[model samples]
Target chain A: MMTFLVRRLAIILPTLVFVSFIIFGLQQLLPGDPALAMAGEERDPDAIAHIRKTLRLDEPIAMRYAYWMAGVVQGDLGISLRIQKPVGELVLQKLPVTLQLAAMAMLVALLIGIPMGMLSAVKNGSAWDYGANVIALWGLSTPNFWLGIMMILLFSVELGWLPASGYVPPAEGLGANLAAMVMPAFVLGNAIAAVMMRHTRSAMLQVLSSDYVRTARAKGLYERAVIGKHAWRNASIPVITLGALEFGQLLSGAVLTEQVFSIPGFGKLIVDAVFNRDYAVVQGVVLCTASAYILLNFLADIAYMLVNPRLRS
Target chain B: MTALLEVEDLRTSFKVESGRFQAVDGIDLRLEAGRTLGVVGESGCGKSVTALSIMGLVASPPGEVAAAKIRFEGRDLLALSADAMRDLRGDRLAMIFQEPMTSLNPAFTVGDQIAEAIQRHRGLDRAAAWARAVEMLRRVHIPAAEARAHDYPHKLSGGMRQRVMIAMALALDPKLLIADEPTTALDVTVQAQILDLLRRLRAESGMAILIITHDLGVIAELADDVTVMYAGKVVERAPVEALFEAPQHPYTIGLLGSIPRLEREQARLDAIEGVVPNPLSPPAGCRFHPRCPFAEARCREAEPGLGPVGPSHFAACWRTPLP
Candidate 1:
């Protein structure tokens, strides 16, 4: 297990480097000039040149990439051209909110998706199963942004039950933070829950029909025990993999949700940085999100080994 | 002495898209204490279904099991509530299946699987159940029982996994052990060893055994009384020696002939003429008429009931004696 983890970490290093290079390359290809964006409609070419020189935008693309790469390795994300502040410090301030939102979204997805999936499998072909399938289909088809808008209109505007937008740190108090997060989390989680539900249901159906499950039933175990102990554990392997992938997606894919909710998260920060031609912030956020995706996939492999004894050796 | 399990007029059917399909049609079986009753048949002949019916393991809605009477230990098993039947299972009645590789749960240790049965029926705590699991493994002649008990099913060979299954079935000291093609998936040597283990266990425990198999050689080796089935119905039944010696039904004779004999000078082993009929649409009269060599017009016009031919021997056929 130790060796496995070490090998995974080794692979992650090259992947992160490649991802950072891509982020830097893509930023250079953007149409707008960072210096001009910073100068903000100034008629004088002198002000633009001064801003470009100060921001090192006058250097060759390869040279600028090398400089940014060196800074990234040393834990310096450089300074935002628009805000004139350290990109690392700016991201760090908003990182917790994104993390909290993603975590909450994942929690909601799992808590509802797994049981509903199991129920659909156990009672396959029944009305309850059909109902779950229909609900999952709707969730999958509906875009998160549109869902977020509807939820805001219903819960915040119509019912006046929750705040329409913005975020509150948990340090301020758990209740207020949860209240502010509910709609965005639900919107983001619904799509993932739909995907997970389908995966889990199919996995469980396959496992439930397995010979071992029959043996479990023939052993005189209660129906619940047969499903829970034998079927569910085996089925969870695929579901866990799906869950980790969805979590990685949730971390980076919350751009629209964060916008609709007006939450100060990394996704929103990155989008804002892109429009302002803040090259450092975009590169930093992309690198972090890509690294998170790799880490999650590695963790998922370990989880598979844990869940299935057949894979351990 | 009374029989350990007496199943009379047992019938099991399934609901298919077309209509109801009878898998086991009007079967009668009796197993006495300390005796071994071997049920021999081809695939799809209801051997496994009979065992599942007796164990109440048959799924409902799509499948239904009905009987005139299914009495075990002087109580009607068919009349018992689901919970009552559950209590009896793994305690008074236990079963082992064909494929050891698929039957044992792969995620759990062999010890844990056996211990689960012990804990469920015997109410043993975890530690005590583990100890009993090791003992059960030892009883099944698995080498290094203590260490092997902790190994998962995937780590064990097919034979060892079957032995572990046997240990699990016998962990609660069940009064009746139903083995469904227990050695079908095993190698020849492993099959012999498993049969020998079962024989020894029965002699030691005095538990009645109902062994299901398609191999007549296994039936000849382990069975005291034998029941031969064709399609979904029992074609012949008798004491092991009588059934082999004076087998009346043509189907039974075909089954016995299909077995390759070392003493015979035949160039090729004989096979039953046709495949077992599909249960969804079996022959109108006799299920085996299509495959029987001696089948006559009357054989295809009407089904025959099991009738006495000799002492402790019964055969189902239109004509009792060959012309």
Candidate 2:
């Protein structure tokens, strides 16, 4: 396992280098000069030139890239041009909220989607199955932004059940933070749950037809045992993959969701940086999200090994 | 001796886009206490379907027990509710499937899968049930029973997994055990061992077994009574000895001839010609007419009903004129 981890990490090195090159190139190509944006239009040319030289803007792009790469190797993520703060500090400040939202959304998806999918598979062709399919279809088809608007309207504006926008740290109190985060989480979660439930249903249907399931039934197992114990566990292999992909997507997929909920998560921070042309902040966030996607996929592979003993080979 | 299981006019079919396909057409079979009744037929011949319908494990969608009366110890099996059927399965009756490799759940420990039925039907607690599972495993001659119980299905060899299947089926000492090609997937030596174990278990438990297979050797070795199925219907049935000595139906004779016998010297074993007819559009008269060497004009026009040919031998063939 350690060897496998080492091998994966080795592969990730070149990928990170490639990603940094793209982020550096794309920021360089943006319309407005950071020197002008930083110093303002009225600043003296000499003063602006001095700031550009200090920021290494006057240096060759290759030289600038080498310097940035060296700093990255030394655990320095560079400074945010707009905020004039360390990019790492800005990322650390916003990382927790995005992680919490993603975790909550995934938890909600698993709790709701797994059972719903099992029900659809178990009661197959019945009204409950039909209902679950319709719900899944709606969840998959409806845009997250539209769903977020409806949630805000129903839960916040109309029912006064939750605050319409903004975030509260869990340190403030568990209930308050949950209430603040839930609407955004719901918007993202419903969409993920739809995908997960469909996967679970299809996987379970396949497992249910296996000869072992027939043997289980021949042993006179109750329908619940036949499904929950036998079919569900076998079906979980695919569901686990879906869940991990959805989790990775959450950090980015929640960008619009975060905007609608007015939560200042990493997703929202990245969106803000893009519009304000904050190169350092955008690079840091992109790097972090990409790393997360790779790491979660690795974890999914491990989870697959854990669930299916046959894969130990 | 009183019969333990009697199935009469049993029919099962599946609904497809084309039409209804009758899998097990009208067939009658009986099993006396402590005896084996082997129903022999090739794949798609409805032998397994009959076994599943008997256990009420038939997948409902696209499949149904179209028509039948199945009786177990004078009680009507079909008349029972689903809940009641559940009670009967694994308690009074149990079934072992073909493909032992796939018959046991890959996710579950072999011991837990077996213990589940024991606890559910016998009302044993977890500890006692587990102990019984190990004991049953030992009975089936699986090596290192106590330790091996903790292992999953994939961890075991094909033969050992088959032993576990038999152990699970026999956990409750069911009155009637339906073994549907239990040894089909095993190697020849392993097959012999399993067949030997089954014969011994039958003797010890005095349980009536309905063994489904297309292997004449298996039927000859294990079955006291034999039923030959052709295209969803019973073509012939008689005591194993009598049927082999003098097969009344042409299909049975063809089947018996197809097997290479150690006792008989021949230039070449007789082969049954042609394939089984599609069930949806079976032959107008005798379903076996297309394949039967003795096919005649009447054989293709009118379906021959099963009737007694000898004292206990029954056949469905018009070629053999009625007495």
Candidate 3:
């Protein structure tokens, strides 16, 4: 197992390096002058040139990439050109918020979706199953941006139940921050849960028909035990993979949701950086998001090994 | 000996787009303690369905135990509530399925799965259950039983996994064990071993067994009595020796003739002429009429009821020759 972990880590390092190189190259390719943008429309053309040189924008792509790679290895992600803060610090400030939201949203989605999925599978052709299908269909069909708006309008504006916008760190109080974060989390997580529940239900349905489940029933196990103990565990590897992918997606794609709910997380941070042509912060966020995606996929593979003995080999 | 289990007019069906299709038609079977009844039929002949119906595990709706009276230990098994059925299963009755390779849950250790049955049905605590699981593993001749108990189903060979399945099924010393083609998935050598293990377990525990299979060879080796079914209905049933020696039903005769025998010199092995009739629209009167060479006008017009054709033997046919 240790050998396996070392091998996975070895593979992950080269993969991350490749991703960072690609992101660095692509950000440079985009038609944007960060120095000029930061200096604003009133700035003199000569001043823009001096700022660009200071930021090393005049360097060849290869030299710039090599420098950025070195800085990454040395834990210096460079300063945000617009904010005048360390890119790492800017990311760190927003990273925890995204994690917290994604974590809470996943918890909510799983806690609700898994059981609902199980119920749907067990009930199969019943009204309850049909209802779950309908909800999931809506979830799959509706765009996240539109859903976020509807949730805000319903919960914050009309119901006045949750805060319409803004974020509070858990340091203020865990409950207070969670209360503020719940709306956006719900918006993002519900969309994810719909996909998850469909996968969970199908996986469970497939496993339930397996011969092992029959053996469990023949052994006189209660229906719940047969479904929960035998069917669910075997069904979980797929659901876990789906969940991990969703977690990665939620981390980066909750921009519209965060904007609607007015929370300052990585999603909003990246969006702001892109608009202001803050190349350093943009590169930092893209690199972080891509790394998270690749890492989560690796974690999902490991989780499959842990959850199902059949996959351990 | 008083019968340990009795199934009367046992019928089970599945609903399809066309209509309800009977998988197990009106049939009766009786078993006594310490005996094996081999239910023989080709695939889709409803042998597994009958077994599942007996266990109350038939996937309802598209599958249902439409009509049957299953009596185990003088209690009406089919009439029992779901909760009561749950209690009876694994405690009084257990089942080993076809494809031992697929019958054990792949995610759990074999020991944990066995212990789950022990803990649920026998009420043994975890520690005791684990000990018993290892003991049962040994009973089934799984080498290194103690270490292998922690291994997952995928870690075991097909033969060993089937042994684990048997150990789990027999853990609570069930009164009856339904083995649905337990040896069908195994190679010849492994199949022989599994059969031997089952016979020994039955002898030592005195449990009645219902062995569902298409292999007449298995029936000859392991069964005391055999029921030959075709198209959801029993065509022949008798003591194994009697059925093999003086097979009365034409379907049985065809089946016996089709199988290659070492003792018989043959120009060509006889193959049954046609497939088993579709269950959805089975041939009227006798379902096997379409394939039976001896089938007559009367046989095609009227169904034959099972009746005594020899001492302790029964056959469903219109043209039985008298002694």
Candidate 4:
């Protein structure tokens, strides 16, 4: 078990390195030059030159990558040319917002998904199963942007129940923060919930039909115990993998939902950085997101060992 | 002298796209207390279904079980409520299945699984159940029972896993143990060891065993009485010695002849003429008539009922008292 953990942990470093390398290399290939983009409206040669030298844009691509990598290693994500602030500070400021949103979205997904999936599998071909499938399909197909707008129109504009746009940090009062973030979180989570529901349903269906499940029932275990314990434990292995990947997706890819709700999160931060040719902010955010993906996968492997005893060997 | 299990006209059918097919077609059985009864047939002869039906483990919806009476130790099992049935299962009546590798949950340690059964039925607390699980493992001759109890199902060999299954089934000391093809998935040597284990366990506990297997050798090994089923219907019922000695049914004779023996020097081993007829489209009348060498017009026109052929023996064939 220790070896498995160590091996999984070891792979994270090289993977992050590769991701960082790719992000840095790919940033150079974009159509517009960051030095020119940072030179302001005048298009002055002195300003462009100054910007190039200052940001090491004048250096060779490989040497510049090495510099950026060095800074990354030391937890210095470099300075955002547009904002004149450290990329790390901006990322740190935004991290909590996106993290909270992602966590809530994942919670919603799990809470709605797993039980629905379990019920769908248990009452397969019944009305409950059909109802879950229909809801899942609706969730999967509905655009987050449209759903976000519709929710704002109904809840914020008409009913006057919630603020349609912007974020309120948790320090401002927990209820207000939740009220503000809830719509955007749901918009992001609904799609993932659909995916989780399908994965959980299929996994549970396979488990419920397994020989061990039959063995479980033959032991005279109650239907609840049989499904909840014996069957659910096995079914959850695959769902955990899906959940980790999905949560990583939620963290990195809430751009549209964030835009619709005007939430200042990684989505807007990273998207704005890409458009403005803000290399430092873009590289830093992608690196952080990539790290999150790796860490989540590592956590997933540990979870597998916890649930499935065979992997401990 | 009384029967521990009395199954009468027990029919279990499955509803497929084509139509409903009876897997266990109104079979009757009576197993005396402490005796090992072997139900033997080719694959798809409904032996496993019968076991499942008796244990009340048959999956519903696609499958349904109906019977005149399934009495176990003076109680009609079919009449019991779902709750009552659950209390009896894994406690008073337990079962072990064919694929030991898959029978035990892969997620749990073998000991945890055994202890769970003990905890459920015996009402022992976790620690006491764990101790009992260790003891059960030791009884099944699992080496290093204390340490092995912590090991998962995947860690154990097929034979070892079968032992674990046996331990779990017998953990509650149930009155009846329905081992459905328990050794079918083991090596030849391992099969013998498991059979020996079962025989010894039965002797020790004196619990009636209903073993379902396709292997005649398995029947000869552990069975006190033997039931030969073909196409989901009993063709012959007799004491182990009598069935082997003076087999009346042609299918029984064919079964006996089919066994390859070193002493009987023959160029070819005898095999029954055809596969067990498909349950969906079984031949009219006697289910085995198509495969029977001595099949006649009368045999093809009407199904034979199980009746006495000798003292304490029965055969279900028109020409059963064969000259």
Error of 3 at A109 (Å): 1.5
Candidate 3 lDDT by residue in tens digits, B81-181: 99999998888888998888888888889999999989997788899999999999999999999999999888888999999999998899999999999
Residue-level lDDT tens digits of model 3 in A259-304:
8788889988999888888888998888888888989988887887
Give the Å shift of residue A256 in candidate 3.
0.5
Candidate 1 overall Cα lDDT vs. reference? 0.89
Candidate 4 lDDT over residue span A47-92, tens digit each: 8888878877788988998998888889999999789899999999
TM-score of the first chain in candidate 2 relative to the native first chain = 0.93
State model 4's lDDT: 0.91
Q: What order do you get sorting by lDDT, best first?
A: 4, 1, 2, 3
Better of 3 and 4 by lDDT: 4
Q: Chain A: TM-score in each candidate?
A: 0.96, 0.93, 0.94, 0.98
- Which parts of model 4 are misplaced by more than 4 Å? none
In terms of TM-score, which candidate is strongest? 4
- The predicted structure with the larger DockQ, 2 or 3, is 3
Off by over 4 Å in 1: none
**A1-313 per-residue lDDT for model 1 (tens digits):** 6677678779988888888778888877899877777676654799989987877889998889888888987999998877778988987898889888999899889977888899999988899899999989998999998999999899999999999998888999899999999889888888888888899999999998888888887778888888999899899999988998899987774889999999999888988888888888888888888888998999998998788888765
Q: Cα deviation of B205 in candidate 3 (Å)?
A: 1.6
Query: Which regions of candidate 2 fall more than 4 Å away from where they truly are?
Result: A1-32, A60-63, A73-75, B66-68, B263-265, B321-323
- Per-residue CA lDDT of model 4 for B1-323, tens digit only, reads 67899999999999899899999998999998999899999899999999999888887888899999899998999999999998899988999999998988999888899998888887889999999999999999999999999999999899999999999999989889999999999999999999999999999999999999989999999999999999889989999999988998898999989899888798998999988898899998888888888889998999888889997788889987742
In angstroms, give how far residue A33 of model 3 lies from its true place. 2.0
Docking quality (DockQ) for each candidate:
0.75, 0.77, 0.88, 0.77
What tens digits encode model 2's per-residue C-alpha lDDT throughout B1-323? 65788888988989898999999888888898888999998788999999998888887887888556688988898898998898888888999888999989988889999999999888899999999999999999998999999999999999999999999999999999999998889999999999999999999999999999999899988999999998889988899999989899988888888888788899998888888888889878888888877889999899998888887888899977576
